[model samples]
Target: MKLIAFCSTGMRVAAVAAGIAVLTGCGSLPLPDKPQRPMVYDFGPGLPAASSGPAGAPLALAQVAAPAPLEGLAVNYRLLYAGSGQQPQPYALARWSMSPAQLVSQRLRETLAAQRPVVNVGESLAALELRVDLEEFSQVFDSPGASFGLVRMRATVVAPLTRGERLLGQRTFTARQPAASNDAPGGVKALTDATDDLARQIVAWLAELPVPQGARPVAPAARP
Candidate 1:
């Protein structure tokens, strides 16, 4: 019994020593690492729906020269906004940036199509020409604590084509809009709100235009 007792003490001491040595040799295992959070950014809702509408056909020459408004009267010429000459920025998920020039052009095109005079799909059918040149298209980041949006833009109408000649009279237009910007998710609301207002202005001005008549029409065979 005495020997058994002695042997048990010896085993306990041995076990303790072995455990201490293993722990000392292994320096503590690295603590479990904390997970990192993802960087968050915002973009507008999903990309616009794919266009399922009909393809656009070319306007006939007859449509182009159909008629001319009285002298000093502005004819409602077909509209065209190609989104050309400007670079549009790519949008990221969760972040709604200002309108892309192409996007803006598209919106303008659709708006006019829905309301204004017959807008040509391209410049070929346009009679009284109104060419818009985007002079500025950029969005600056709001500095920390700033409460307003950072969007600004400038554009000029470079020409008003009347017949074979280009009319250069009063050919400039500009628009600007900013909002109570919060770095918070809702910041984008300001941009869209302001944009809506600007769009209304454009539609109103174009709606008042006089559409020309008496212009020659292209035969249906010539229509694309």
Candidate 2:
């Protein structure tokens, strides 16, 4: 009887040890980590509806071209005091919905369409063309606490020809607006305001140009 009791006690101890070992192994396993999502931003202020303007041959607006740094969707900024030679750096957590060039082109097209007839590059038939080169679009920090949004672009008007496109006129536009704050949201607002001003200037410049031969002139009633 004594031997049998002793054997039973040993089995119970072994079972308890096995259960503890299993629990310890499970506790040592690592849990899966959660992924972080980036924030996306875009230009604000709703565009106005298209208004009646002078009847004319459809003008073509090409996609704006930008340098490699501005070509990406990332929101970029410059630390002027860090080093004049340093290239602009992008915010890791914030990004634009589209590239700066694309946004500018969209804004220009919408603004122009409201003033006159405009179409995409492929739709225009021997019509006047508008090409844009985006040189700068960034939030520049003059110091650790002060900053501004800067924008610069070159606009060229081209007359389509049987053989090649002829340059009719060209101009460069630059604008800077103080940021309400030193962060991405503030930069966006300033850049948007700058773009609005630039668009207005371009429209005024186009209004002064002589109507193309095939294009109809703006009626006095349609003139803004």
Best by TM-score: 2
Backbone collisions counted per model: 15, 0
TM-score of 1: 0.41
130-202: candidate 1 lDDT, tens digit per residue: 3333333333233434433222333222122333333322333444444354333433444444444454565
Clashing pairs in 2: none
Alpha-carbon lDDT, every model: 0.37, 0.79
Clashes of 2: 0
lDDT of 2 by residue, 58-151 (tens): 6778788898898898887899977852678887777888899989988888888787788766564635777789999998998989888899
